[model samples]
Target: MTESATDTTPADQLGSGPGRVLVWFYGVFTVAAASRSIVQMIMDFGKAPLAYVLSAIAACVYGFITYSLVRGGEKARRAALVCCAAELLFVLVVGTWTLADASAFPDATVWSDYGMGYLFIPVVLPVLGMLWLRRAKR
Candidate 1:
């Protein structure tokens, strides 16, 4: 279905209310992961390449979701939903990997121990984003 130009209701806005909160969290996570990864990758990438790289990837995913939310369209909503799913999958895989084999990650990633450093927000945020996106559907 095609969306009209004047379709600017709050329900149609992915960045409204709770979606706005999602955007805030995603934006914060983007900055946090990006900066952490950039510094780690620059200073001591060889020390824990997997962790740093995973953090960088997480940053990219968070950045994309934040952008999709702010863009506020059906296409953007779908994109955000898909990214949230991927983010959750990454969190679970990485979280479990970090726990199952500590040697694999000498250092911690943003999703390490299921975002223990960040209060598990990394795992929870994506689920909330997906729900909000579904509700904001046009």
Candidate 2:
């Protein structure tokens, strides 16, 4: 059988081209956030419980987005899109909260100051992921 214009292979759908970069970034962020939170929780949980927990949550979101991108399917695409949106929301809220009240976070979460500590990747990645996922639907 011949392939139609819409008959994109798995690679063409997601986890290819820019999606590959997304996957790589997400994977790295996942590990980074997880490690930071794990170390903080073990070493000084009481010092900044909120910050550590937020970092852990960011790690989970990054992990899920990475998985969905690598999985490469319509379902996975949808899941990634939703997670990306949620991740963006969390970053905005947490970032704003951190800025508004310095005492609220004695330590920085992965998303502190709109991910300023990580060069703002935490804030930018989700927007990029959402755009890429939207294009992938085509």
Candidate 3:
């Protein structure tokens, strides 16, 4: 048996296969980061403004990547790739900053300690996302 070009269904897009898993992960992070930031800000913004703000930023990045992955196209894939790279950089910078100057954070951002609170998933996810996006390009 042979499959034709039309066999490419919607499920065969970037959001399918491994991309589906990536979307799920990104979606989870979006909610986690957003809610955590919101609660922290509401509870005591003055306590750790920098950490809360960073968490909010992480939430936005995660949300955008989630949307792009689900949207599924070359453009969306490229957008996701860029976001993933940015996410990785954010994690690295914030992680190092938090360590180098603990007083500046007061509390932990989503990327603090290299995502230690989240079992390092935040740090690893973007790397996996970039790789997946690259693979989907071909």
* TM per candidate: 0.93, 0.92, 0.91
lDDT (CA) for every model shown? 0.92, 0.94, 0.91
Off by over 4 Å in 2: 1-12
Flag the better candidate by lDDT, 2 or 3: 2
> Per-residue lDDT tens digits of candidate 1, residues 1-138?
888897777765888887878889999999999999999999999999999999999999999999999988778888899999999999999999999999999999999999999999999999999888888884
- Which residue pairs show backbone clashes in model 2? none
Which parts of model 3 are misplaced by more than 4 Å? Answer: 1-12
Clashes of each: 0, 0, 0
lDDT of 1: 0.92
Question: Ranking by lDDT, best first?
Answer: 2, 1, 3
Model 1: residues >4 Å from true position, as ranges?
A: 1-7
Query: Cα RMSD (Å) between model 3 and the true structure?
Result: 3.5
* Model number with the top lDDT: 2
The worst-scoring run of ten residues by lDDT in candidate 2 lies at 5-14
lDDT of 2: 0.94
lDDT accuracy of residue 121 in candidate 2: 90
Rate residue 114 of model 2 by lDDT: 99
